[model samples]
Target chain A: MLELQGIAVSPGVAIGKVLILDREGYRITRSQIDSADRHNELDRLRTAIAEASKRLEQHRRDSTEKIGVDIGAIFSAHQQLLLDTTLHREWERLISDSCYSAEFAVSTVLSRYAHAFRNMGSDVMAERAGDIRDVERTLLEALGGAPLQVSGGLGQSILLSHDLTPAETAGLDRSKIIGFCTEAGGPGGHTAIVARGMELPAVVGLGSFLHRIARETTVILDGFSGRVVLQPDEAALKDYRQRMEVRAGRVKQLTEIRDLPAVTQDGTRVTLLANIEFPGEIAASLQRGAEGIGLYRTEFLYLGADTEPSEEEQTTAYREVLSQVDGLSVIMRTLDLGADKVGKFTLLEPESNPSLGLRSIRLSLRQPRMLRTQLRAMVRAACGGKLKIMFPMISTLHELRTARMLLRQVIDELAEEGHQPPQKIQVGMMVEVPAAVLMLERFVREVDFISIGTNDLIQYTMAADRSNEYVADLYAGHDPAVLRLLQTSVDVAQAAGVEISVCGEMSSNPITSLLLVGLGVRILSASPASLPQMKQALRQVRLEDCTQIAKRVFDFDTAREVDAYLKTRFAELLPEMALGV
Target chain B: MGIHMRPADLLSRTAGRFECQVLIENNGQSIDCKSIMSILTLGARQGTQLNLRVTGPDAQQALDALCELFEQGFDESDSEVATEQTS
Candidate 1:
């Protein structure tokens, strides 16, 4: 029996025969072409090139029809690479002049270009090496070489790969793919994001040991714990089977309440919303019964771009998202760039401590043009559907007022330009910093709503970076100090008659959601996948019970004590909930 | 075909076309136009003149299309919004 530990990107337990997708770095043998067969060898090269081009064009069309035009452009580039006269001539020359075989010639020429791309000294350029390699493999397959494609059939085994690109992940056959593990990729990567959206169990960053695991090996993947056990003993297999059954039961229970309202037994209706970064996620969120989009992270538009997106570009994107969401309100967070999430377009000096450095609202305030451009697009997109603009990392009232002022200015400017201003839109602030929580009373009166960004709030309150494993233990939302702040903000917002939502990781946790509801937080925003589970857990507990639980939780001194108390309490109250939490 | 452009900008506009190799040589730097990474390494900017060389079955057609693209200044009409969602 062998075990591998990795970062769990998605939650679930999957057991299947391993199907290793060893596509990268496939070996190609070099050989001399016989003089008698040189003409046939050249013909083989031409046929291979044409076949690869046809396949790429078909993939491009399929991608356009299934996903969108932008992704189809990737395959279009591949097609262009196939038709590149320079590359074609290089291969032809190797066959005619160097007397190299077609497959060897193609491999050698493509790898030379791939190496050139990799040695470009730019990260963006280096990434294109993967694309070159992808095209090379496709050409090799067309040349009667060993097939590099992953076969998809019903009930196929789990996929293990070095890494999966966005295109590869998108093309995944949902019916065949049981789950996937990769040696590289983070939780925020496109592969993990798609896995979460598809509700597929995935574990990434497993390191190189994963590559050594043979095909068809029986393995148990615990995505929740980010562990994969290979060739387990009978006792271990039995235990895993029981755990899987329990999880399946829990999932079945959650699915039963998928369409049900997130209300307690006492009829307190708490709104459950989804936090989405891309417009493609709206379908999944709505399918999972999200009331509305609570947080539409807009920073993604600016990140990974060579230049700043024009106002029209931004408007087109926002409008597409708004139009798709129907009439559901979308709280669009304006350009939350800085600290750990800096974009290429926005230039900021390197900081020793970026978490506390100039970022978010501060960065926006410093570069008002960037904020104005986004605000203009947002205001324009408001015509498509219900829109709510939010400013992130508001540490002080001054920053909030300044952001509000800039928003109003953009509205007025648009009006002057003969554009009709949005009739109704709510402006809000994210209560992420400690100062914002302390000044909750003042903040509640200023904005239409308040979103408690528990991720950053807990990190800042505990003086710990959540991403750093060394400080991860210190960064707990259930800590008395953090909980008190959350409670105070909820209390203040309730009193002020302003809508407040907990749009953070904590809102997804059953125990924390119970505590949030007990503390009078009426709205919770989390990933769409967690919505059903959150609703299921929320429906079982009465508001009175939650209130008592919260009261007892508050009495605890340390986060550990509070966590233990809640676990025991929930175990007694709801046994199924205790198992998952 | 005198306008200078970055590799990504050029690729975005023309990479969807037929599979034909294009080579651009300028100031002693020779690079593959089909490969965005190779083009980017050259870092050609405004006013940098490049000699185009095309070779393949569709070399003439590829050359004409590329020359026309360069002549038109790679100005993709704003009417068609290519929405590539980043996440």
Candidate 2:
């Protein structure tokens, strides 16, 4: 058996036959067209364009219904590119003037644009090249070209491809396809993101060796460990089959308890919510039995667009999310764009140190109109269902008070416009900055609730940029200083009788969940996929046991000692809950 | 009409309903106006005069619309609102 290792993007296992989908060498050959047949060629090109546009429109509708509007927006952009007059005119001109075939002309023009985007040295621009190529392939296939055979009646197959665009992944037949592995794409690529949303077992960035595997080969794909074994022996296959059965049994056990509340054995109740970026994720969150949406990132509406979204547009989106949750509280964080996520409309000048530069609350306060527009939309949406507004990255009390003032102004204006104010509206702050942690008591009194954004809080506390691979070792969430800060904030919130929730990657981890429970944090929000596993872990430990664990953990000098102690304790008390550190 | 264009102006205007190639030439450098990256590379600030060239079946119509857009100063009214807010 040949073994390949890649980046594990989603967690699951699938043993199935392989379906190789190689679309690398579909190049257009330049051929001459007679002058008499030039009109026919243009007609073919127009028909092909019309067919491609129809297909893209259908894909956009399907993706919007299946995925979310943000993912569907990718297809919307593709449709816009297909309808671009410049691209259409360029290809038409090339076909008429150069006496080249329609396929050749289309391919040539698209390649030039794609190459230009590729050489631009920006990740956003580079991704556009993939979109251009996707459109080109669709048009070429419509021109009676080589069939880009990706779909068919395949039973229980793992799809292997060179790479997959977001549109392609969204359009896959999920019932027949068990898992997917790509020769390209990192953990952060759109393919991986969509795979996680679909809950499909996936591994990516395996390099070109994956193309060498023959079709219909029995392969074992372990997406959690990022291992793909081709032509597994009998013993290995049997072993994997047993492991799959175990996982299926575990999943069934978790689903049985999904409807039950996440309460400790000692009668202490804990709230488990889901962190979502798109409205499409509400179904999955509900299926996982999330009590509410802890963090709904609103920056997605502003990203990848040339113009700012209007208040009406933002209202429709927020209303859709609120309606989907069906009265479950949705804490919407307004437009956290900057640092690694600068959008087209929220462009800023290049900074040498963007992590410490103007971002989050700073950017929102600088553009008060933008902030006001979003707040108006949220207020309008709140009239329909439960909605809580939260300000992110508030380093000081001044920023919190200013943001609250703007929110109040929006509410008063909406009330004056004949719209009834929301009956129960809560405004909160994300306690991520170190300064915010120090003044948690004062901040808690002013806001309705507080959510600990541990990802940024840990990074800022350690003085390390987590995105920088060089200092990644320094950015540990288990650090004693970070835990102490978390404990302090939770203590302050509890004393003030305010609700506090931990919504970050730290709360998603099973071991860390125990420590957080011990620290007086009764609410934990994680990704929807991890909610079941987290609930299972929480149900296995009592609050008193967790408190004792936390006390011992706090006495440790370093993060390493705390992690080691927790790992050993969890393994002994709950072997099934042992997630390797 | 010769007109200067900013990055945002090019990004917003080039996606208009005209199936034609709009090329902008300045100081012997030329690139497609439809590409935001190309326009950004030009670094054309306010009042940097650019020569416009249209080539396609709808060249005349595209050129006319583009000239009208330029004559209106690439929709300066929106920028004026933003500037007013900041001031």
**Per-residue lDDT of model 2, residues A482-501, tens digit only:** 99899899889999999999
Candidate 2: list runs displaced more than 4 Å: A1-9, A14-221, A228-238, A304-307, A465-471, A579-581, B1-87
Model 2 whole-model lDDT (C-alpha atoms): 0.77
**lDDT (Cα, 0-100) at A547 in candidate 2:** 94
Isolated chain A: TM-score per model? Answer: 0.71, 0.71
**TM-score for each prediction?**
0.63, 0.64
Q: Return the clash pairs for model 1, or none.
A: A83-B19, A83-B20, A84-B20, A84-B21, A85-B20, A85-B21, A86-B21
Q: List the lowest-lDDT window of 10 residues for candidate 2 chain A.
A: A22-31
